[model samples]
Target: MKTIIIDDDATARLLIKKMCNAYSEIEIVSEFSNAVDAIKFLNKNDIEVIFLDIHMPLLSGFDFIKTLKKATKIILTSSDENYALEAFEYSKVVDYLVKPISKKRFEKSIHKLKSVIIKDSLVRDDSIFKEKQRNELYVSIERRLVRVPFSEINFVEAKGDYVKLKTDDESYIIHSTLKKIEAKLPSDNFLKIHRSFVINLSKIIDIKDNSVLLQKEIIPISKSRQIELITRLNIL
Candidate 1:
């Protein structure tokens, strides 16, 4: 993610940059001592994440969040733990780090950033960072929320703690269970043929023996759901 450090304290900025070095995903594009200059840079360029200081010389962290023109994820860093509650009130604020930030807590914040798939709202004026999630499934890949339409899904495979969403072009690994995702998918298209697999009925090429063929892949159909699958199909 293209990122920036916005803290008046040069030492604080250096520490944040050092902590961010552990993750390859975070690329520090620039650093700002004041929020006003950061806002100007934002107007001309696109930044994915921001490491902001709550107390600054020019504009405070809360004031800076209010000045954002578009949807962008922010991690607030402050010495005061008092603002943690107030910080969460803003949807753009992903994680609040109390300074001096610990290495373990920083790692947790990064993990949270990569796994956040849902939000009540992204930003004011309702600009949801090009991922509003309407009649679609939002998969968190890296630091972005990717939208996958139900029509493009060929099947879903359960992978322990995660589920793989197979599409015509690309496949995504989402942090969700098969049962939870099944509830979100429409009943007309998606059907659970097995405990570990859910297949899109329209994508099925043929059903042979106890398995169904979708595209080039063959998926097993459990005996318990065999009759249900047959009833759903238009058999001649």
Candidate 2:
């Protein structure tokens, strides 16, 4: 797995690097003295694990974690123990190691990293399989089966008992509920932004505050769905 070390202290960075070198599975891709440089590197590179220091010169480790677009496993190395509970609030933070870390403790952290990586890989593979199996959907319209490609769909809206499927060139009002059609759509491409609205993430032209612009229509995004939508986006 590719790994990066971020610590203000040169001695601390060296110690973590030396320990990580012992494990053949880990490859030290880069090291940084501050979170700013690390964030810059993270923007362009994909890393499996980050060995981070909780306290830094400018940006704290927790603040840095919030800036991440992709979900990457994090192991926090800090001298203080008071922030352990707070550190676990972030789902990506797998383990917290106190300063002067022992080899045994480091080994345990590595074990946790391996477990997370395996689980993530399985989930990714399952998602890929689902995507490969369902690329297009057939909808009943006027006694005819109309094939709609997932990529062409812009959004779906609830209109009384029926749902309207809006595409680039045309729109179809099917005799179905939004909930029913939502299940048929791929989760990676289609997201239920509101109780009445399911928007294709790729078709989004702009997102401002609580609303998203798709073609000419502005759909309101529910508060609950905002976090999920932001997580799906590759924001810098």
Candidate 3:
């Protein structure tokens, strides 16, 4: 899980980080000494879990929970055990670790998280497998059907009579409509951002104003499709 540690005490954060590093499942993306800074990071990032302290200055953990735009899993790391019952009232608060935290206690909390993730992982893994199976397609070139994988493709553009498949290795001009090509491509990664263009969302390097940068090329995003594109993005 992609996680971040938030605690007022630097020592407690360090201890939690160290213990988290021992597990392969936890990937600590960042650490914050306060919830305010952590909230800023969370706004632009997709975080799976958070290690938060309850009695921090300025914002209490309960107060911080209300600021969230989306429900995010939080594990309380507190010195006090009095608020355990109250903390469990929040649906997103998974496990509470009373400080000073023991390795065994932390392991138990992680086990709880793992159980939930493992159940969800099965469905995600199957979807990934299905996505992988359709990674490539066959295109008619000079009367011969050539196989092309989606991984190598950057984007697809429509010419008057043909659709141009722009890939890393070469561009193939196929006598097909953009709509037909778009239908063949995977919907998760490929998006039709304009009337004449369909882009690979994963290949995008940056987005500025009304344009998306893909390696060396900048594709214009139609005002009509701009919101759909943004909604599809894993915008952090």
- The TM-scores, one per candidate, come to 0.51, 0.58, 0.51
lDDT of each: 0.91, 0.95, 0.91
- Candidate 1 per-residue C-alpha lDDT over 112-208 given as tens digits, one digit per residue, 9 for 90 to 100: 8776623323343266533344357777888898888888899999999999999999988888899998988888888999999999999999999
State the lDDT of candidate 3 residue by residue for 110-197, as single tens digits: 9988776676679889999887768888899999988899888899999999999999778999999999999989899999999999
Q: Which number leads on TM-score? A: 2
User: In candidate 2, which residue pairs get closer than 3 Å at backbone N, Cα or C atoms, i.e. clash?
Assistant: none
Q: Pick the lDDT winner.
A: 2
Candidate 2 lDDT (Cα, whole model)? Answer: 0.95
Error of 3 at 189 (Å): 30
Which residue pairs come into collision in candidate 3?
Answer: 44-236, 45-236
By summed lDDT, which 10 consecutive residues of candidate 1 come out lowest?
116-125
Give candidate 1 misplaced runs (Cα > 4 Å): 117-236
Worst 10 residues of 3 by lDDT: 112-121
Output the lDDT of residue 130, model 1: 38
Regions of candidate 3 where Cα sits further than 4 Å from its true position = 120-236
Cα shift from native, residue 119, model 1 (Å): 8.1
